[model samples]
Target chain A: MSPLVEFRSVERTYPSRQGPLHVIRDVSFTIERGGILAVVGESGCGKTTTGKIAAGLVDPSRGTVLFDGENISGFKGPELSRFRRRVQLIHQDPYSSLNPVRTVYQTLAAPLKRFRLVKNRTELLHKVRELLLTVDLTPPDDYLYKYPHQLSGGQRQRVAVARALTVNPDFIIADESVSMVDVSIRSSLLNMLLRLNQELGVAFLFITHDLSVARYFSWRGKTAVMYLGRIVEYGPTPEVTRLSAHPYSRALVASLPVSDPRVARLRAQDDEVGSPDVPSIQNIPPGCAFHPRCPLYMAGSCDRDVPELMGMRESESLHQVACPVVLTR
Target chain B: MSIRSDSAPPASVDGATLMSVRDLSVVYRVGNRLVRALSNVSFDVMPGRALALIGESGSGKSTLGSALTRLLPRTAEITSGSITFNGKEGRVQLLDLSSEELRRFRWRDCAVVSQMAMNAFNPVMTIQDHFEDTAAAHGLRDKAKIHDKAYELMETVHLDAKRVLPSYPHQLSGGMRQRVLIALSLLLSPELVILDEPTTALDALSQRAIIKLLRRLRQQLGLTMIFISHDLSLAAELADDVATMYAGQIVEYTDVFSLFDKPKHPYSVGLIGAIPDLSADGASLVSIPGSPPDLVSLPSGCRFHPRCPLSDDKCERELPLLVETEPGQKVACFHWKDAQTLKGSDAFEGRNS
Candidate 1:
């Protein structure tokens, strides 16, 4: 299956006070058509930045992102606008995502009007109601005249989702969209995305810090484990989850609260506190950026040279892990 | 690794309730109509024990927290609810507290470290300034006394007292700020402390740090706590007892272990199932279909019936009452017995951990 979206050696560097910050370091992955690919990492891991790059909100410092096998990295003008319409980005805060002053009707109508998706007000209103029902925000008429403040948190999130679908984008870059919403409604929202993927053949570049959520979020072409600002491990969710080749991936899995009471009780004794320590991009270590904290680090080799993204010690497909432990083995 | 409880608390309190919440409700008026944020809620908070008020947003978990502290926005009205301190007869209807009484009772009687509560501190103010203000308000006028107490509080939360005392809120990481807030809540050793989503904004490491620190603190001080949160996992990690609230009403209240292991209410089971668990494999994401019912036009029977998979016609017309079944567990579901048949499927098991 060809990918609806593909990242080829994508890198994003931000000019910081002291030097350039390597936000995305030699990252590459793909989201197959109708797939949900989640990039799991802690905050400040450049996961959000990578999502923005895919959505065309941020230009990459190095490499290209292809959509439908087309290199639109430098594409601008009408073509870029069309790409923007075909791709949408959902923000984190639903409360702030919509205009507080406008009613749901106006807010929904504004996008349709801007995109010129509909001309007449009557038809536009009908289309707005259609979008609302599609997202399961039923009895759409009730929400038509309601202001953002009048709606509940879950309702607000649905509005945001409806807004994102206003342009009928085939690909969505949902960046922590559910993190800010209540946990009770979050599952339903994720299910909504799943349904959309299956029903509309839409693709998603989901970004989140919750590892479990990413795993359950369905078959993203590849699931990548990001550390500081690098894709340390990228592979099929099941493969990477079962045999986490990279040290960072191992730590991440171990960090998740064990759902089994027996294991959680035992884990409660370990003091493996995750204190994120990312070196300033400029003053990076000689060989491996993760060597300082890597538990299985072989002193000389790990510190002397950087590891590339490869499935050297594993049956290579899309399962890419950056570690000598796997590579040397 | 750390002690679970500092010391067991005495149950009898001279024949009086430890914490009494009368017809407690909170409403924030937007334009013309009043948004019923919380409606006719009541619960008790006992010393040396925790009662977690669990609910999703707009479910009024934070509103409930703010009501306990008399810190609701000016527009917000405490329609009714008299929160009386256990040790003292100083009863103040959180809604009825006079400005002076609110000033007096703010942190000394019941303190708050709210949701994203790290932002509770003013960014411009130093941690020392926050401590001094709180201590002075409680009559800890001696500068040295306040400073010593603040250092001790920091130590309790594993914060570097010396380094954090002079730093600003912006200077500390999310976890550090949370720890500072927890430390500040202890400044007066307020018998009852209200924490709203204290660890929700934090990472797993920070969350564990807060949870473990709180467990230790509970043992040392025997603090009466009212923990309000949306995250059941964290709630299970800390709260001894849990109360799952919905549409402004508690659906279930029981021991933390039982609540997670076997929930009596459909809403409780759905809440537990909805959480994404990393340890559970192939646990495809499951979301409760449909949104929470509108409180204004609440369903006649169980407010959760519309979205509840177990709902029947009887559930739609007649309301279910919260009846005590087991020793500690209470449920509002008309058919809670059927809930026992809940599968330990990917969506239903929240208690294993």
Candidate 2:
């Protein structure tokens, strides 16, 4: 069967004062039916843009976004509406994503009514309460009439998740979905998503700057690391985190704050290469974007040649890296 | 690592106790109702050492920080407590100071670096103007002397003095702005510095860099630092001691090293287990079930009993006091010893049953 969603060498650019700025470069990946693909990167790395393209919110400047082998750029009218109903986007900030004035019942019912999933008021109320229950907002009646302001951050996020599920979408682009929630209650939300993926067979394109969160939510799934709008590394989540090939990935893994004081104390030393600053996309280096900060950076070739993503260390695993040193090895 | 009594210092701490807080309770008058922001909160910071206040968003960590600096909002009041700070002029009661005396005490004796410090700068003012304004307020009037001191501070924080001095706050990056704020906080060379989630807004790389810089500055300046963060892991790196708070009360307090390896509180264990580890694989994050108790109408006894895995009938009726369970480790849980062996997955098991 064809993958649920695929990016075929997608590239996105925007016109700026400094010339045509390439926000996404040569990005290609796929999310299988009921599978998860976590895109991990920091701010201004185009992860959010990639998520937007997948959700049909933005059109890519170049290349095709395939939905089950059908190019999404060609979608129009009924086809586009069908795609919209099948895929959803959950934003980062629960505080702002929700409509403050609308009651939770209205928020969930609007989607059901828009998709015509429920016929009458009775069905809408029952479906809305069921959606609330699905997202672990217990006793739906208590939460149905409450406004967004009446709920906590975690509850607001749960309502957001429930609203997404109202239309029965097969895929979700959770862009930092739980980042704004408190750490203590984050796991419950993550576990709810996991249950949806398993029981409902919903695919997830989880976008976050946190690698640990990516690994936690998509343990048995795929992970793609982006830097300067490029997919610098891609592989199974365990392989990417446990044995990171890219220097950038290594730096990210090293920089994660571990709970243990003894372990975290020893890692206080600078594990990253080069300067702490990330160079602007407008003034990206000629060769590898990460070469300036790469610990294993070579003097001549690294500064001259742009490396493409390739397999590393003769590994048969799905691990691939875009670094001159790793590609040569 | 063996647990020591509360009085016994950890192997790393050799400095003298700089300040001690006793029975710190803060209440806010939200209209007619009284909201208990903090209740019976107590902790200590030693000279040249860091004490981390760790908790969730509404756990009163920020309230304690504000109470220490006497910067509480108009609605909030310290109902009962004594905050004693050891200064060059000997010990002083911080809460007892008048508004005028408090102004003189602030920035000169203790300083605060909050999450908004980066955005706290006046957007219209140049970096030099900010330095001049702060220094002048603290009684440094000479322009040339303030300029020299500002340049010295910029150099100390690894910023180019000449370039940053002429630029406004909007011109600098998030990391650079934070560094400038830190430099400004140290303008008076205050003995105590309270950092409340200083790097929460920065990226991972910048957060790591800022943490390293703060650690170095704390040691070099011999400053007593109270680093407050929701991230226990990040706090463990910079702090000598860790105090975990929940619902305005401290649940656990111990040396940083011991707190991680053998947390004596169920809440602390649950929090540590909830953190996603980079190296560990196949371990699921475990969340403490149920939300925090409403401060306006708290639970019957133990505020955390509603969500605690080891809670029983006794835990629901009697509020457990912060008692020394081990040497140097204090816990307020009734079943911390039983919860010690519980791992990430096992910590929250049998909850639904």
Candidate 3:
């Protein structure tokens, strides 16, 4: 079967007073049916923009996004509406993503009622309760009447997830969904998403800044490391996180503070990046965007030539990195 | 450093205690309800050492930070406690200080770098103006000296002082703004610095940069610090000692290595296990089952009993005191032995390995 969602050389830009701000450039990846693809990056690296484009919430300025072998931009009328229903976007802040005045039942039932998925009030109530149970809000009656304000942060987020599932979306764009939640409850939310992916066969395009979180949720899937609007590394999650080929990816993995102090100390002693400054999107560094901060940065070639993503080894390994210098080594 | 209870003797070993907090409790009034933010919290801040107060939201870590500087909101009240600071001048009671004396004590003796660096700065003021205002407030009349000191401090933080000093806070990135705040916090060269979730808002790379900057600052200045954060990894990275707070109480206090490797408190063990380790080989996370209890109406006896796996009738009836379980390790849980035994099992070893 074809992939659930595919992005072919997607590029998104916003017109700014400085110039056309390149928020996303030459980004391409695919999430198979029931597959997971985690896009890990910093705040300004356009990971959220990538998710928006994938969900059809924002149109890519260049290239195409295909949903189940059909071009998303070309869909019209019912097809577009169907695509919208099939793909859901979960925002980062559950506190603001949910309407304050709406109860859990009201929030979940609207999608079902608007989509005409339920015939009557009884059907709507039953479906909403089922959705809540799927998201693990037990004794659904207790939560059905609780307002967003009445629920805790974790419950509010779970409600957000249940609302996403109301349309029975084939694809879910979770944009740092668990980051705002408390640490102790973060894993439960991720576990819920993982279960949804496995049991329900729902694909996910998980966007997060946390490498560990990305690695954890998508352990069996693929990961794409974004830097300044480009995919610097794209490969199997374990391979990309454990044995990263790109200098940027290596730095990110190494710089991450481990729970163990000995490991954290050892990682700190590794070669530090040359610079910590990230250039503005409007004035992104030429050639390799990370060359300025890269420790193994070559003077001439790194500043002059734009590197493209290629396999690191001679064999047909799925792991790919966008640094020619590393590839040559 | 030796472990002791709240009623233990004054700092006699491992140098003098820089700040001693004894039986501190804070309450916040919302409507008619009085929310207990901190309950009999007591700890000593050692000079030139970094101590991390690690906890999740509503764990009273941030409230403790605010209470240290007496910066709590109008609704909040420090009902009982003694915050004594051993400064270069003499031993002073922070709680008893007059408003003018407290004003001098805040930036002159101790500085607090809050979590919200984005909103910390005055948007109307340039970076230079901020420095000038801070120095001027501390009674420094020489503008040139203030500018020179600011320039040197900004450079110390690895920012291009020539460009950054003139630029507004908006012109700089999140990381740069955070660095600016750190530099401003040190403008007075206070004896201690308290950073509350310093890197919580930044990206991973920027967070790393700030971490590196803080580590360097600690080493170069021999700075005494109380780092407040919910991230265990960060606590492991920067802190010499770790204090685990749960439901507005200190559940565990020990060195960073001991806390991560052989955590005694059940909550600390669960918290450490919950963190996703990049080095670990696909280990399943063990999240604590229930959410933190509301402060207004807390659980009976031990606050953590509701969520603790080791809770019993004794735990539900009697509150546990923070007492020394071993040399340099203090735990408030009655089932700390069980928690330690649980940590020795294969599951935790597999994840830690």
Candidate 4:
């Protein structure tokens, strides 16, 4: 069977005054049906752009975004609309992402009415409540009449999640969906994601900068580390975080503060995030974009040749690291 | 250089304080109905000390900050309570102050360094002019002296004086913008510096830089501060005392050492549980089950009762008061004693929900 989502050598770029800014590099990955894949990176690292492409919002500059082995890059009109039903994007800020003027009923009903998910007003109301219930926003009656601003940050986020489920989409690109919500409420949102993945078999491409949230709270998922618009590492969540192969991944994991002051003191300091500059889509250096800040970088090899995604000599698992440091480790 | 709470915790800050906020509440009439942005919330920021108002968004952290500085919208009515600032300005209730008086006291006596640095600075003007305007407005007629002072401040806050002085807000990076704003705040040397998520928008590098600079400034200048943020770990690093705020009320507050070492409140315990401990097995985070309460129509009893793991009938009936826990710490919880009992085994164990 074909994978739920496939990006075969996909590249994205945008036109700037100076030149074309290449936002995403030759990114190629596949997520199985009901799988969760996290794409972790810093600001301006093309993670958001990647999520946009997966959501069918934008066409790639160099490659195509395929759903179930069908290239959906050039899809339009009915095909696009159908793709929209199968693939939905939820944004970071629910308050801004949602229409403030519309009531929750309108917000959830639009998709139901458009997609014919329900039969009549009674059925539609039931469907809306079910969607809300799946996300743990119980007793939808309490929220359906309320405006977006009437809810708390966390409640709004849950409503956003509910909206994404309105179309019964098989796949979702949750673009930092919980980052703006209250930290106290973020976990409940994560729980909803886990339930959706388990109960509905919906695939998630969770994009976030918060390492802790990405650490399998939503669902046990494969993790990818992106740097300078390139996938630097990919593996199981446990290995990706606990046993980080790439220096960049290691740096990011170390960056998160711990409770104990002693262990926190002994932990390695992040060799700067290299100024969060991927040098734009057009100007990324020929070799490793992370060479400037890499702690274990060998000047000649790292700057002269970008290492291919190669696994450690002995590990059977697909834990690939794009760095020369692998030889030493 | 570091003050340890080990020997004996500091003296209990009595009701006789430097600044007193009495029955403070902020409510906005958003339609026909009234929305209580902040209920009967109250806290004090004594001289030469800091109070970390910790909470998630809509917990009235920023609303409380605005009330103290009197910078809320005109529609916002301070329904109750008086926040009296008794410093160099002497026995002045912040609510009673006229626009002109608030303006004089806004930055000179009480300056708020907001989260968004862009909004704080005038984009068209140079960084130097911002300091000059505040200085000039506060009756500093000597231009050369102010210029020198601005330059001195630039160095003090870890900004390159030459590169930052003439640059616009857009020219500097987000982190640099934050540092510039912080430097600008010190221009008048305000006695009370109220910061609202000062480092939220910044990257890790800039966050570290801004935090370090704030610590340095606090240590060197002896400025009493009320620092507000959602990130407890970041708050734990800077604040002397951490006050966990929820539903527009102080749920639990203790010195950073006690808060981190031995959190009395279950809400505080859940917060610490949520943070990913990178060093410890990178275990999963045990996040709180529900979100913050809606201030407009809060639950009958405890606002956090719904989310609290140890919540009981007492928690559901009577509103918890900000009562004293350990010395110098306070927690508004009915089951602090029982919560303390459950905390020993599972509180720190297993991060997974």
Measured by lDDT, the strongest candidate is 3
Stretches of model 3 off by over 4 angstroms after superposition? B1-15, B341-353
Of the two candidates 2 and 4, the one with more favorable DockQ, higher being better, is 2
lDDT of 1 by residue, A197-305 (tens): 8899889888988877777775444588887778888888888877777877776776665433334434644324334334445666667777876667788888897
TM-score of chain B, per candidate?
A: 0.87, 0.93, 0.94, 0.90
For model 2, how does the per-residue alpha-carbon lDDT over B120-214 read when each residue is reduced to its tens digit? 89999999999899888888899999899999999888899999999999888787888999999999889999988987888777788788788
TM-score on alpha carbons, each prediction = 0.85, 0.94, 0.96, 0.87
True contacts kept of 3: 0.66
lDDT of 4 by residue, B96-213 (tens): 8888998899888888899888888888998878877888888887988988998898889777899888888877778778877887888888888989898888655457556667
Accuracy of chain B in candidate 4 (TM-score): 0.90
Docking class of 3: medium
Q: Candidate 2: misplaced stretches above 4 Å?
A: A268-270, B1-16, B350-353
Q: Pick the candidate with the highest DockQ.
A: 3
- CA lDDT, every prediction? 0.76, 0.86, 0.88, 0.77
Q: Please give the ranking of all candidate structures by lDDT, highest first, separated by commas.
A: 3, 2, 4, 1
lDDT of 3 by residue, A49-146 (tens): 99999988899999999999999999899999999999999999999999999989899989898999999999899999999889878778989999
DockQ, every prediction: 0.43, 0.71, 0.72, 0.37
* TM-score, model 2 to reference: 0.94
Give per-residue CA lDDT, model 3, range B279-349, as digits (tens): 55676777665578888888888998877767889999988999998887899999888896554213332
RMSD to native, candidate 3: 3.5
Clashing pairs in 4: A21-A281, A22-A281, A22-A282, B284-B351, B285-B351, B286-B351
Between prediction 1 and prediction 4, the one with superior DockQ is 1
Q: In model 2 chain B, which range of ten residues has the least summed lDDT?
A: B1-10
